[model samples]
Target: MFIKDYISKDYPAFNASDSIEVANEVAKEFGYSHVFIKKKGFYLGALSQQFLEESAEGTLATLEHHYEKFALLDDGNILDSIKLFHTFNSNVVPIINKLEKYQGYLSCDDVFCEFAKYPLFSENGALLIVQINNRSYSMTDVCRIVESNNGKIYGCYISAFIEDDVQITLKISSENLSSIDETFERYGYNVVLKYYDDEKEELLKDRFGFFQKYMEF
Candidate 1:
């Protein structure tokens, strides 16, 4: 998926000449936290609601904090855009041409909708999560291991921890869980835990108890 597939054609935008008050109204009317600010149909940055509220200066263009990096979309796949969105921890990404002309915007909702079409997890498959110390943690080792065991890794996710380590989540479909576990363990990845839905009744009960208490509160 790319911005072409997920960006809303009707989404609101702003221009440099637009007053800060006008931007605020657009944000309020559309219920958007930020609006794409453009000039001569070229992508500039963004004007956020927080920027407006925190700014005492009435000048919209003079507000230095109103500027932010536009989430540039080159000729890339939807998965690539998803990675960028996650890396930046941003909700909206601006699409642009090679010459840096503004195209449109992609929202976080669109990305999740695209991913939800695929499987996030599966009980028929063994899920393994590995923790490492770098974002560049290679999946080649696990991919090779799964293939060697006649298994298939359906998807993978790599994230960083606050303590400088990285966390990898993998979804593997296999007939033998023990073999997969042994292979991952051979790679020095500590197995945190393992489970199947049939074995999760007790676990669900404990979790539900906590959820019930939280709901009551």
Candidate 2:
């Protein structure tokens, strides 16, 4: 989804001339570690709790010297926001318009929620990882095999690739994937990994845990 759809104005922003005390108050009130600083309508940067605590007696303008100018445009996608989250290790990211006007911020929760809604994660399905030669791979045959076995593909993604081989991860709607597995084997596709509901649940739990820990910065 587009970043603007999930942009939130709930988080507070401070004027460049505002005090670190004001920023700290707003952050504490909202349970945020950082707050955005703007000059007029344009975004200047962000001030973090650690920065504010270390340099308490300063204006937002002074804190601006230490702020990281991380932001995404209004038309950017969720992937773009995710990159920013990882790069800056921030819980929230500022969104700006074409004119560089601060629109709002996208929170970690919002991005995580959006990610959870993706078919690969949200759908009740089985995951199959297949290894295949890059030059010989054909998605048409893969779909045919699954469909022929009365299985429905909810989603699929390419995981990793080497020079000659690639790994493809498929999310299938059927719980019983024996026939599909046999079909792939019959067609000479090597099944590298498989995950059913129980295994997928554990895997996702660990993944989300890592995601939460990653966002804590």
Candidate 3:
């Protein structure tokens, strides 16, 4: 999804002439660590809670030295937003238009929710990690082998590409992976790791439950 689609315009923004007290109140009301600052419809920067609480008295423009300017353009996608969040260690990020006008802010929670909905993460399937020489790598053959064993591939992605080989991670709809694993090995593919709900149902159940609980928090 695009950043503009997920950004929330409901959040507040402060003017350069606004006071720290005003920014602090807005941040508290919105449960945000920082609030955006703008002047004459132009994006200025942000004011952090720490800066507002410690400053004696000053306008947002005067006391904005502590805040960093980080934002993504409207054309950027979810992956771009995620990278900025991790790079800056921020829970919320701003979005801007092509003209550099502030659009809105995106929260990490919302981005993560979108990510969890991806087929790679949302599907309940068997995961297999395999290594094969780059020269002999053929996704068609992999699919053929799995299909011959009555298995359906939910999704697959390349994990790594070394000098002479590549590592691939496949998500299969079938839980019974013994025959599939043997079949892959027979075709000269090395199975590095295999994960299926059938063999580790209890472990997966506990972990998934913990993840759900954590997300709720």
For each of the candidates, the C-alpha root-mean-square deviation to the true structure, in angstroms, is 6.1, 9.3, 7.3
What is the Cα-based lDDT of residue 133 in candidate 3?
Answer: 97
Off by over 4 Å in 2: 162-164, 186-188, 198-217
Backbone clash pairs for candidate 3 read none
**Candidate 1 residue lDDT tens string, 1-217:** 6556665657656777777777777766766667677778877787667677666645466764558765666565667666656665566677777777777777777777777677554234667777655654577876787788888777877744647666777777745667877877777765665654434666899999999999998
**Residue 171, candidate 3: C-alpha displacement in angstroms:** 2.7
Per-residue lDDT of 1-217 in model 3, one digit per residue for the tens? 9777798899877788888888888787777767788777767777667668888887877876766787888888978877767776667788888887888898888888998888778888889999999989799998888888898888888889988999989989764478899989998999999888566878888899999999999
Q: How many pairs of residues collide in model 1?
A: 1
* Residue lDDT tens for model 2, 163-214: 8998888999865599899988887889999877777778999999999999
List clash counts for every candidate, in order. 1, 0, 0
Candidate 2's TM-score reads 0.79
Per-residue lDDT of 54 in model 2? 74
Order the candidates by lDDT, highest first — what do you get?
A: 2, 3, 1
Name the better of 2 and 3 by TM-score: 2
Q: Rate the local accuracy (lDDT) of all candidates.
A: 0.69, 0.84, 0.82
- Cα lDDT, model 1, residue 124: 49
lDDT of 1 at 205: 93
The best candidate by lDDT is: 2
Candidate 1 lands at a TM-score of 0.70
What lDDT score is found at residue 24 in candidate 3? 86
